[model samples]
Target: MERENAPVGPGDVVALVDGSFFMHRTYHLAASGDPARNLRPSDGFPNGAIRKFCERLLGFLEAGFGGTRPSHLGIFFDHSRRSHRSELFPGYKANRPEPPADLEALKPLFRDAVRAFGYGCIEAENYEADDLIATYATAASARGAHVLMVGSDKDLLQLVGPTVFAFDFEYGVPGRSGYRPARLFDAAAVAAAWEGTPPERLGDVLALMGDQTDNVPGVPGIGMKTAAKLVAEYGDLETLLANADAIKQPGRRDALLAHAETARLSRRLVELERNAPMPVPLDDLLLGWPDPDVLFPFVNAMEFSWLGRKLGQLYQVEASSYPSDPRFAAPVAGSGAAGLQALRYDAVLPAEGAPPFASDTAHCAVSAMPLSMAHIDGWLRFDFRSPDLRAEPGQGHEGWKIHVSVDPGRVAAAWDAILPIVAEARLQAKVAGPALAGRLGDSSHRQAGKMLVLYAETAPDVGRWRAVLTRVEEALDKAGVTPGPRVAGDR
Candidate 1:
């Protein structure tokens, strides 16, 4: 969520997943035929279901989650068969068969997998993930965050609007074997899919057609084409029912007139309850770096070596491998990127006029060191003059995004250290005037002096330097990487 006055910028990204749909899709599609036949873990449990889900989920993650690289990611599961829709109509989804044993068995593992990736999971007793996904998507859209509903379920199509898109990760590009490309569906795509009827009328279209899968009884003998035409002409089911007698064809008009209530019931069944209460804060769902501990072991056990390889590259810390490296042995030889070995580096603030201890000084000057953290005490110090700026492809030259680390325990301490430096930068920027200062949201400020200045947590507050400590704290908890104990909490 955002502040009441937040302006809708390019907006942050969020992905809402439909867990129930994934379970069945992955279980059946991972293998050639048998549901139980696929890669099994060391424990001999069938993992095809989970494996397929992982592969598809990774595509979303790898693609920066439909190119938004969502800061908050969520997967929602339906724990119960009953839902508000089913309660309203007992025959809702009555024709659907029981889920496959293998698919049903993978729910717990799926939940664990989602968590292992530093993402949140949601569940409700009498609400389907579909409804919850729609709720979150709608809320995110209204709040000005771009939402990607990561599922192929048709029910989600209606939710596609400004700030809310349906990214069907399982969509096949056709004739491209082993190449299921993720397709981004906007309002235009939704309208096109239903043949000229916009997403707003999806419920009405479905109501008249009557979802045979869900056993929703529409007016008898009204086919999909007929229903779509009626919805397009009438705007909605209620309008269509009210003006049924106007239809040129008496047969279809009579059917609509006779079963007006049935059409009404069907529309209610497909309509998404976008206001359903969410179980967790929407902000907490942003995807962060997955925990290496949980991710690596889980992938290995699932026999997803491909994913393991990617994680290994992305998460590798060479410091563990380069003990007594020659680069460290001689400062003269360690200045270049060729022999650069990542070591667990820590630099405490030295006393004024004190010499920098006899060790590597000029080595590896050019780098993009994530402000992973800083503090009030001299425990850590960063020099703004020698920032290691690196170009991130497609991210443009937003140097402010240079900081990536989140240390929960010492947010206060970090701010304390940054306050004076940031304050001086602000003052200098003001003295230089807006013409000299770089942009700060809608205004301009002297940014050169404030190289160390950071962004605020919300959009309205962006470009303004303030503590986003809560977001940082939540990020730590999500990554399972807690910061060390602080002096205040130590006692």
Candidate 2:
């Protein structure tokens, strides 16, 4: 996190991200075969929002967008099931259903992007992403640093000011005839968007308008225009309510009187928390380019071959292999699968009783410390219908493929190229784990030729190793994989 001789204050741009805000958008894009539209790998795995976020964020850091790059970046994720606002008002944001299955599945990858880039992730047990963004924005502005809140959550508009801004690239990009462009809003811009009400009163204005999405009932029958007009006149909800008797329209006046409590509650709900227990220090969140070791492997595993290659170029590393490499093969997923979900399969059998790994078995789960290349250890449990798996039920795998490259990085990439093709009888591997850990401890590394195949009888519920591993299990759907005929006791 240390930046020697780094400039602070005025020119320092800190972008605070709302990770959960993008989950809904990912749900829609993930339905596509190529979320990034970068060559359409068609592997049937769609982490659309994750790919979009990681790539765009990487480009932003690379100064691909027209702006001086941010000097500090903090990606705030909402991990708490409910925030303090939800606790105070049981119905706050209760109208929203549980996050979609795909979105929930890709949540880890979202955080993985931040860590892979050597960025700090702020997650609180009782606060939402908006609150953490606000807390960071306030902290940055206090230090004279320019702050950009990277989300379109309207409730966050209240935090807009001279040193703090809101950037909604997702929606703004669509506004530009569907080109991906970043939209930044300062105090004046926030005011313009809210009908001349200053940023300070955005919460108040929303309090009067009533957010149907949040189930916050504002004054009855008062629409957005009237709410803006009322806020412009009275400056805030308390003042507007204090002088409700002076209002001219009979219905508006009656609604204001009747729903004063609701207005106050909505204001409280809409207000951004300028102070919350920060999950990490501001200094720790100081931004930098992606860490090559971590970034390369992750983007490769996520199947963002374009970004992975871009990162390889940026970091001066070799990640992709030549198409003609004997070890590398096209994804073997069944017809009509999204490219990201595709993994190359090989019939390599390991010495008996090998431990789990990200790319060692038919269904593998990998995890390591957040961004560290530390003791990279996780187990793989094989679910073989028999001691051996085959394309045809009574036969054996055609043969084993053994690959070796001198450099650990290249070898890992080469192995990654050959390990994930599990859709056929040859037994493809669906890799789901902490794919970010790179240059794993070589001493503990299992050679590509020695990976164990876990037959169903010997495959333990390795899910017990970690809670995250259980969720990782969700990534490999039985339906997603070409279900081979199960021969009970075949092991």
Candidate 3:
């Protein structure tokens, strides 16, 4: 039979994902079960594999449609071992090993990561995700939408047809290696390899052979080639059993006749349950890029360093808002009061014998990278007056300007503490600025006093400065240092 060209058109495509099975395979291969390496401290389990799997999945989705937007998509996962398949076979997947303890602990993190991408995860008790996919794939095909069942599982091939196709996201075209789309078990293709019998009869073929992988015991000595031959000659296990004596090989024939009942049971086990109950609707599977805020945090936590840049690009394209760049003024070399090339962005206190105007002599040095300047807000400065200076009848004007700089490493910590205060102040300025102006507040406090001058060009991006100020205030409060009256200015 001639192969058809790849499906074309920009029509709606629904991806019925097998999350649990894929994740199980990935986690087994990737996650190192070391508790110390786990990012989430609450649960001491590591999820390195899940993180990698998610990144790959994201990459696949982004590249699959040649950058064309997908129409509908939803992920389905198996709940647990109490599935109906287990009930039917009693030994279904029982041979599989339990997940590592660390992996088991990271299950919630994996679930959260998937949900963060805005994909719904469905897992019903006692029903496998494969069953749900089969049911949904059939339902979706009936609705006139193309269905792409994303998985490596062969059982899914049974659901493939004109509208439904199974893509093995494991082996396909070069870059599209993971996407394998095949029409439901090609009868003609299987027959060419198996010598006349179609793939639809593979269940019957397997029943006679017994799948050792699934631990089902077929007639003891009969192997795959013999099984395929018998099914091809006799049409099916039932027909082959009726004419058991017609078998050419005495030993293989005796094995088939003696274990005929076992073959029938294995066939039943291999058939997919097409009528499984699935509540997911085709309309509910709206697909698009993931939300940035939700997606980035998980990406960061997972330590997907390479994906961070990709995420930033995707976010810029999808988000309504963009991060702004901070502007900085040119710095004057060796011009600070201390003759230092770099000046700290902070507040300074006045000292004895210091000229009231001496603080103005202190120079502000700007950063070459304006974005970096926004991080150094709330630096302190101190001016000292001469000992001979008097309070009431002040005489001496001798003083030293003390410039305080904050630790760059602690900027984020400081910013986190102070952001709420700055936000609150901004809100107040918006809501009660006029009301406060008319209330006759302390005029002296607002006049020529030592003020914290933030040299960053963009005040809105100065979150780190605000945070530093918060930390400084907390330290001052603890140290019993009463801050003198001051003003704040931003350039």
Give the winner by TM-score: 2
Query: After superposing candidate 1, which stretches have Cα over 4 Å from the reference?
Result: 1-10, 33-37, 41-43, 65-68, 170-173, 176-182, 300-303, 317-491
lDDT of model 2 at residue 260?
Answer: 90
Best by lDDT: 2
lDDT (0 to 1) per candidate: 0.57, 0.58, 0.52
For residue 420, give model 3's deviation from the true position in Å: 37
TM-score of 1: 0.59
Task: Name the runs in model 3 displaced over 4 angstroms.
Answer: 1-11, 31-45, 65-70, 170-197, 300-305, 317-491
**Could you give the candidate ranking by lDDT, starting with the highest?**
2, 1, 3
The TM-score values for the models, in the order shown, are: 0.59, 0.64, 0.54
Q: What's the alpha carbon RMSD for model 1? A: 19.2
Q: lDDT of candidate 3 vs native? A: 0.52
The sequence of per-residue lDDT tens digits that candidate 2 reaches over residues 228-320 is 998888877888899999998899999989989988988888887888988677866667665565666666666777676777776677776
lDDT of 1 by residue, 226-271 (tens): 8888888887888878888999898998888889988888888888
